[model samples]
Target: MKQGAQGSAATGAGDVPGSAVRVPPQSRGAADADVDVDVEVGRERYDAPGGVRGEHTHSETPLPRPRPAVQRASVRGQIVDALRTALVAGELRPGEVYSAPALGDRFGVSATPVREAMQQLALEGAVEVVPNRGFRVVERGRRELAELAEVRSLIEIPVMLRLARTVPAERWAELRPLVEASVRAAASGCRATYAEADRAFHRAVLALSGNEQLVQVAEDLHRRAQWPLVGGPGLRGRAELVADAAEHTALLDALVARDLDVVRALVGEHFRGAR
Candidate 1:
């Protein structure tokens, strides 16, 4: 994987590159090294409030490497991404009490890393951390989700339309695989993988829009609003997945033709479908 302006390329045999805010590779603690490892486990699980599972596999092999000393940013990144995913997926319901220690246990790490992660999440509006008490997942009402989707439409759709025009042809070559791969993953019922790939595709489009700040804001908003729709338990059924795949293809065709009106309408319809 090639590194992009916003994040590093995924390195290592089993490692997958993740967004700066939402990615963490699976690895075990130093003490559990000798066990018979069938499932390659992520160091943390971002379970939604009702136990919504994200991208994972049973037969995947663990990466063979020594655990590096924990870094604060990395731990915080994992926590933020996990909690954000949970919030979007409606797993960690609003007002739910969460213990830093329990989170630490769940991720197969120590309390310090979990605490660090929670603090970052609180700053992002995904959770609230009291000084003496632990953290709580912030509840977003359905109305809030609707309003958020509206706001995202206002911001993202035009940019996506503009990107189809302004971005150089060479960059389109770079982006094609991201969209096609996402469609393939979604078609195959790997929702988690599809979600990840879809995010990369959109982010790649945002990158082409030539506005870094807008891209950042869009990502923050997306983490809270859009992710849950696909990441949540409600995501299933081959028909729905096929529809999503078709949407991606339609968007691609519009981009290729530089049909701003068509792509804009497609973007609007795509998000409205989520509602």
Candidate 2:
């Protein structure tokens, strides 16, 4: 699962071609005349006037500050994220073989990170590795999608119902932001964004159950359901996503009200519609 400037200029009296030499304090007024004074030189270089040319006096410009380095882990994670988005958007068609080097060129990254990201996807069951070739996007159909949704419903609906009875209304209300995020993402018509927000909302709700194992299992199932189908419309249209998101809001309200019947109904309908 995708788990988603300054410039400065300075001139001194030393600018004067014939100004008094700025000697070190130790050289002029310090009690310890024999003591060495270490002067830390900056990157900036100064050139002496032509008449006073010295060995150290040559034209030089300060090197530009190094840009922040992109870590290898970060690159791999980004590739994973991008691949997930592509999967949801149907841009990465199911059953299509994609080589790491080819996808690396598409993402403008090195093939190593792409390969690492593909390996992670393979673990998630989003793709399968093909020896001497590349990874192939797993082909999922409506039947599989429905099965995943049913499994999720079997796991999540009971937990949510139990939580509704035990967990406080305020606890459920805290998930409003996640539900609203789903709504906004759905309205934006970005399947990838909506997919993530959808999972996040459900995950947050399940997390209230205080069962990490349940949450993990439910989240994995939820992610699998969101993957594109092999045939037919793999991704829902904006209207469908919006309607689905609205059910989340309604479900949240029912949970907050501790209406077990309403929560159960909403959850059942939501999962059915997921098919």
Candidate 3:
């Protein structure tokens, strides 16, 4: 499965500047060229509501002197998070031109923050700036994504194994609620919610490993995989959901019991389905 499968480009309808755009080079080698994302992101233009333009105002009634920094930081954090979610959800696709004006309109803010957010995304390798075009999506190919999955497994399963050894019996008590959330969300037919819950379950398992960096990398890979995996075909069926729930159960059991082989096999099975 391709990681973050949506084409990473966004189109701004010619209103944004070219220098603001960045295009990532295609990553797939010869074997994967036939894969194509038919989904288009900017087909219809969304206009701002009448008489309201995209701009932000510093709160005028603020009494505290330190409030300005806090407010600015808060808004900046929101903008960056929104942009990241947009990219991960395929609200933007690769090679599409991103118009700061259009995004500002959609986000109900002025172009400045939109521009700043794009820059931040670019720095994170989430989006790129095109020399002559506005922002475009970064293209991640199938093989590359698969390789990333392999790297993730390498980092994750061992931590799970070590975690199996150290976590006290009482701490094992915490995972059931997360597992229950996965079951319920799966039944509810919300793939996003289910996936998040599912990720939480796995994360909880690894958290016991006591290695923060490894956990962090696993999380980054998982987050990077979200757009592709959720958007995949065969992702919405009840059987798929049930299978995932079962897998989570099996994984948790294996960890609690210190069953290394079961843990490895469960992790492998999960990634295979992802492909």
Q: Which candidate tops lDDT?
A: 2
Q: Where does the lowest 10-residue lDDT sum fall in candidate 3?
A: 48-57
lDDT of 2: 0.77
What would the C-alpha RMSD of candidate 1 be, to one decimal place? Answer: 18.8
Candidate 3: segments with Cα more than 4 A from true spot? 1-67, 229-242
- Backbone Cα, N, C clashes tallied per candidate: 5, 0, 23
TM-score of each: 0.64, 0.72, 0.65
Model 3 RMSD in Å is 21.0
lDDT of 3 by residue, 1-275 (tens): 12223354433332334222222223355443323322122232222222222221243231222234466666667888787666644567655678777888988988777888888878767678877566877766667668767877888777766777777656876797887888887787655566678778778777777777867878777766654432333434766777778777777777677788998898877765542
**Residue-by-residue lDDT tens digits, candidate 2, 1-275:** 00001111323223333322222221223343322211123322333332222222134233343333457888999999999889888898999999999999999998999999999999999999999999999998788877887888789888988999999888877899999999999999888899899989888988887899998998888878888887734447999999999999999999888999999899988987762
- The lDDT values for all models are 0.64, 0.77, 0.63
Q: In candidate 1, which residue pairs clash?
A: 26-42, 48-91, 49-91, 49-92, 88-228
**Model 1: residues with Cα > 4 Å off, grouped in runs:** 1-70, 85-91, 130-133, 168-170, 188-191, 227-232, 235-241
lDDT (tens digit, per residue) of candidate 1 on 108-213: 7888878887778777777788666788777565677777778889999878877787776676777778778877877786545555666777788888767899
